[model samples]
Target chain A: MKRKQVLVRIFSLLVMLSMLAACTPAAAPTAAPAAEQPAAAEPFEIAVVVKITGIPWFNVVETGVDRAAKELGVNAYQTGPAQADPAQQVKIVEDLIAKGVDAIAVVPNDAKALEPAFQKAKEKGIIVITHESPDQVGTDYDFELIDNVKFGQHAWDQLVKHMGDTGEYAIFVGGLTVPLHNFWADTGIEYAKTKYPNLKLVTERIPCGEDQELARQKTLELIKAYPDLKGIVGFGSLGPIGAAQALKEKGLTDKIAVVGTVIPSQAAPYLKEGSMKEGLLWNPADAGYGMVWLAKYLLEGNKITDGMEIPGMGKATLDGTLVKLDLIMDINAENAESLGF
Target chain B: MKTLLRRHEAYVLLIIIVVSIIITAVNPSFFSLENLFDLLKSMSLMGVFAIGMLFVLISGGIDLSFTAIATVSGYAVALALLRYGDSLNIFVIFLLAGAIGILLGAFNAAIIYFFRIPSIITTIATSNVFYGILTVLSEGKWLYGFPTWFGDFANIRLFTLYSPAGNPYGLSIVTVIWLALVLLAWFILRYTVLGRSIYAMGGSPSSAERAGFNLLRLNLFVYAFIGLMAGFGSVIQALLVQTVAPNSLVGKEMDVIAAVVLGGASLAGGTGSIMGTVLGVALITLLGNGLTLMHVPSQWYDVVIGLVILVSVGVSAYRMRKNIQRRVITETA
Candidate 1:
């Protein structure tokens, strides 16, 4: 019985090996939707691993990947773990590496945790592209849909637009330890300090954006404690939603403004109702499309350039494996639906 | 004074008043009617979770899986409602969530009962399983865009009172459900035979078995009740926030457990009260609100909270050891 079990395991291993070889770079792509122009080039395989699958944010990313595949005529697809955990994300990356895809793109759940996996992928000669994570170890390049500094500056710009240089505002990041959120908070606060000197920050950053409930509760207290407050900057996707809910509950919806990273659909009702004036975010779809396109460009043996255009993501300026795009979207009540989830 | 000091509820209440006074001194708006109403609303969801934990603690059993059960059941209900709940009553939706929670709780109960394992270990294991299954099913998705009627149902309020600033605030549905659950939980613990049995079990499971209780049936009832409350809390939570982020609720068990334990509930079981639990939760919420209002640096807030919990629990424990009467009896089997 033990010998038979060993034989079964060996058989499965052989099958998996054959499957991997069939899908590896330069060996697949006939299934691609017919493109407008079919150039004579072997279709390279690219895989984009998101933070998690089946989420509205990443669902939009999937569409961008498919569109890039159809247009660029590459065997590009998207996959990720069901949950947003570094361990799960790392496993998916390892699997993609084992499958020997020509390129791999990731929006890491935890950039540090993926360091070893990215290093392994690099050793295998796979071109690695990352979105929302820069300065990551062992990566071909890291790209952002929007310049980080400007994204933060733009958030303050929205706040100042509504509050007219502001009376007082507070910032809420997802957490104090979240690097991206803190970076945005720092830049936004700095922009407000110089550009709109009258715009006062009521306090240092409050870390509660990841939890809608905590954000709402904190916003309630912020309003009560600082009656002079005029605006709030929410530096996480759920941050704006929770702040808006607190404002609506207080009937201060029209009195105070909230603007920052927000899911357009989640923030739409509030925007229409005047709890928030504007929400600033980059489309995840653009990030998804841009990364895959960059991966294909590199797999074709083109060295990274200073000012190359990433498809659908505008022009990219390179900075030592860190790419930045001057792309940002301002979602208001009038145009939220058009952005797509 | 000594009698009053002996009661845990009075002790918690005193701490709350002290905290409130300090906060009001720092930010006069802390005393504002609008802020008071808002605080009440915010406490409701955590209030429900703590009540369930209180029961579990009093029964000498620990449940680390309520948060997982709550999120999974709540997310499922939200998705189902969005897909096929046009004419269904909102109350029925909440009930469905509770039923799902009970089923999840039953899994914990079955394992602990059959294997005769410690509940803490069993629930810790179940917490991961429940969360894993939920993550797989939901893919960490957030369910939004409820039907118009659903939003309307969520917005139902007891009454709206305008603050001096013309800002409206009052009792919201979340608070109302929490208040109802509190009263129901209080009754079950205060007036039922099953309630007495639970206390007995916590005090000594062997003694409880000797006292004519059906151990299996009692275990099932106790765990199922925790499930029931978890389910209800999840619905109220999702309704208040207007979205279901499947992953948000799991890591919050620590705070809930902290509140329950802070209320003078013994980790070893057999001693606690509803009033103490309520006051304990209020103190925690007050500090949270007060710190943010005082503009204390965010990084230092957790340190302050940890210190406060340790100090408060420490003081009570020391006082009990010194001032309270104790009868120690130990014997060979």
Candidate 2:
């Protein structure tokens, strides 16, 4: 009788440990299917793969994804590469698929490298969605959320409207080889050629490689290279923030205007300082939320038609292989104060 | 299989050649002299680190901390320039980076020697400490904007040689420096008693000790030597890239290990060639470039690299087993 009690205690301890081990930071996307589903329906599981973990951008997106998962009565998991590693991300997707996750969404480190993982997931009858901008999308990724070419053209149009379409301009790119950033740059350059033919691109390309200090250095170089440069277009999040710092350091806030894709909060302080004119970004939080909703909806045996009305997000349309969100957000000094941190 | 195993670099070279053909088939411009020069220029950075690591491995020790030390010291030099803002010479930064690398190496050696910790653990811990130091120094930010003089090595090429149609074909000064280091290392390993001792000790430390060798001293000496080489290599890499991201060389230890193993180093202790190590690094860089160019899809690069690693280890294991079986048979006879 005493041995039986001891065995029971040990078994209970093992169960507790296993539960603790399973309670990872990544919330499982396969729990609690909506009550509206048939009694026999199982919950859907989805994996959210980001560039790297422990960043504010990814953290916020995780929160939105988790919230959607909870609201829609599904399980969601948020995991990423320890660093921005394509190889690691591929491994994560493989693991997720092996574990029988319903779908996998990724913010790719390299577009071309991730195609096989996505293709394998599709072969397993799993949904593979990418949140890359159109310009940055690799031929391998099934589809991207936003068209980067349109994003670049739109950004340039806004910059033209801000700077009156006829002035010298420069670009602060993350890296010369970062495909997405290069796409934005190419499109911006094309726009410059077509619309503002006289706007000379100073130093050809400003590749900061996502280093804020390098971005600042490149910005200073731009200032020195084109003394009368009127506007700057930054490709990634860091480029504009770094450019803002360079402008502030040189006291050229009023002299040069800045614009790019970055967090509104990061751009707000600079916007307030008048070193940065404005910034643009898609609703990454909503994008995260949308992924969870889609994962759950598809898992519930709801077929993915061209026009799918989500619970609260209204109708989302699929343009061929692409899912269009039209989720762009523009931030300027006037309204930057109101955006959530 | 036997032929391929004997000439591992040939296998790698074939992969490179195959990849080049595919890339040229897709985008002919990728096969240009300029692109090849660019490939050489970029690869020389890791080439320097690989060469130093080759020495450490030949001596039966691993310096997993070298890249981190290089990055931390490189950033220190960057910060010093930022703090001094124009009073610093480009040469001074290189000196400072070297000093940091040497000090870091000595510190790692001292810990392993005194504490009797496994060299692997010591280096792994030091890797974290070094990376942490960089984070503290930069506060998770990056340091950039060195003067043109600091990065002049990136631009200078041997008398602007070009292809017949006038494309840039000459190698960068950095590649020339790396190749010189490789040659210098080759000579030392071939001629020097200390170099031979390193290999002997690696092959069998217990036998080396029985033969009147100082195990502790040699361990310290070898690791320190690797550190010094790593320091200089880091500066070259930093200068060539013209930027130092705090986390730039993270996880590159795996690449270093892969290169060494590919060069035919027995991780069980001794038996690797410096020439093989060079080929190993070249093959890896080539594989990366080739896979990307081939449009085999990005995900396949990892698969390809993983397969190469598996095959290399498997070949080594099979050869070792065959040798053991032969020795057993000879003794029985």
Candidate 3:
């Protein structure tokens, strides 16, 4: 009975300690505005949450958030789950709500999974701005850097040009479930079918699981399987990089063309060598910067009307709380280094 | 010849051949020399880990921490390379990685030996700890920007074969290292006193102790040895890719475990061979490679691998039952 009492005490102590720890970070942000701004009004505290932290894509996005924070004088910071798990992301959002941030901007891994937490944040009067997740509900606005159909058509045009308008081409996406990636793949294939009659897809879109090695191995096998394959359209950032590496190693760069939504830094060497012919992506930093800008715009009683200029993101079109922008950056050897991401 | 046919390694070898033949029949490009070399090169990394896993399995312990050891050791090497720059000797980086691996391996061994906790559970916990430390230290960032020599290391081809189109292909130095490790492991397991003790321990711990084998020393050595192999595997992987992602290798412990188990190594303990492990690695690698060559959807690959494991285990169980029945009949006679 004495041992049992001790165990109960210890368990309760642990519970208390964890609650304190959770409250500590939440408390620190609140204290910051009070301590720093004694004379002026409290700065808008905007928290930008991404799908995952510590990846190169989101790392670039964080830089944008930092840039916007500096420029706008808002207490803006970015946080996300370590892994791309929707449940973890929702937890972060809930914690942010508890901390009483004025606004929450998120890029969700799963749109439906995050709706409940987002709904809670909305109930607490927290302004919610999301990027890259158009289907996300319970948000004041969800912003997209590129129009899905337009981007798909653009990628198809580039692939057609490279393939001389005819050959067996393969398509790869980050995963079967990533909605945006699949949208791009679907529209790209549809556009190709209508616009370029000669080009053919070798197989249904293969999923890379966002892994570079998996992409590389799949590309290697694809090359072996289809000797006359002329082009590859990669829908994820790492897909083209992996395909290019495989093609470069086999000395098939001259024979085949590869294009994808790849980071400029990773695709630079491949682009220069003609292994990777083109890369299509919007500036992630811009998207990151834009989320905060949109959040602050809504917080200050601004309406997201069509053609209204967002500071970081240029002209935006409003479609039922979804702000879409056409900001695709065409990456090639000539301008790869200048982009820096 | 009949006995050879009945051996597990022989069955695995036959599977490899059959898979290759079918894949080649569908796509002749799969039978090319360059493709074979590519498949072997990819298999070398997992092949190295399987050797270490073989030791642990034979000693009646399962290690889930080998990949974690590889990640931390590789991260340490990457840090060393960054700190020392061009002036640092490459060999020293490898030695540092090996040392870190030994320390981590010792930690796992000490816990399992001292507390008598199940090795699987201990390794699972230790893997998380090792990976957590690595993530905290590196911030889950990828390490790149190695010296020219590091990049050059990956391109060091020995006995090159050139295609008619002038594309060079051959075995790499890393693959050579992998081959050497396999030979060394085979020698130790087949011909050494320590190896016999490990098998004895796995077969029955109390009897091994009665036979005067030091269980604690053997356990420590086996785990540490696996760690050492992990360290070497990490260095090879770093050299192979020329960029190290800390998180990329953590989830691959499953592949190593799968390969070891598929090699006819009984998870319950004691029976495995270096040759069987090599064949197992080759079969798994070829399955992935061949499926891709056949334009098989990537989603189906996981299902296929799961089915293959189930079937292979079933075959082994059936063979064991038959062997036992034969022994019983002879004893009755």
TM-score of each prediction: 0.85, 0.57, 0.87
Give, for candidate 3 chain B, the lowest lDDT window spanning 10 residues: B1-10
Ranking by DockQ: 1, 3, 2
Please tell me how candidate 3 rates in CAPRI terms.
incorrect
Candidate 3: global Cα-lDDT?
Answer: 0.81
Q: How many backbone overlaps does candidate 1 show?
A: 0
Q: What is the TM-score of chain A alone in each candidate?
A: 0.80, 0.79, 0.86
Q: Give the whole-model CA lDDT for all candidates, comma-separated.
A: 0.79, 0.67, 0.81
Measured with DockQ on alpha carbons, how good is candidate 3?
0.23
Clashing pairs in 3: none
| lDDT (10s digit) by residue, model 2, range A158-204 | 77766667778877666554667778778888987988787776545
True contacts kept of each: 0.58, 0.00, 0.35
Clashing pairs in 1: none
What lDDT tens digits, residue by residue, belong to model 3 across residues A1-341?
A: 22243345336434644553343223212112223444477889898887766668887898898898889889888887665667767878898899999999988777888889888987899999887777777888988998878998999888877878989999988877676887788888888778888898888788883677778778878877877899999987778877887787777898889988987877787899899999888999998888888888889998879888876467888899889998988999999889977
Worst 10 residues of 2 chain B by lDDT: B290-299
Docking quality tier of model 2: incorrect
**Candidate 1 segments whose C-alpha is farther than 4 A from its true place:** A1-55, A62-128, A134-138, B1-6, B319-333
Query: What would the per-residue lDDT of candidate 1 be over residues A137-251, giving only the tens digit for each residue?
Result: 7788887888898888888888989888849888988766566788788888788778999988888888887678888888988888788889999987788888998888777
Instruction: Write the candidate numbers in order of decreasing lDDT.
Output: 3, 1, 2
* DockQ, all models: 0.25, 0.02, 0.23
lDDT winner:
3
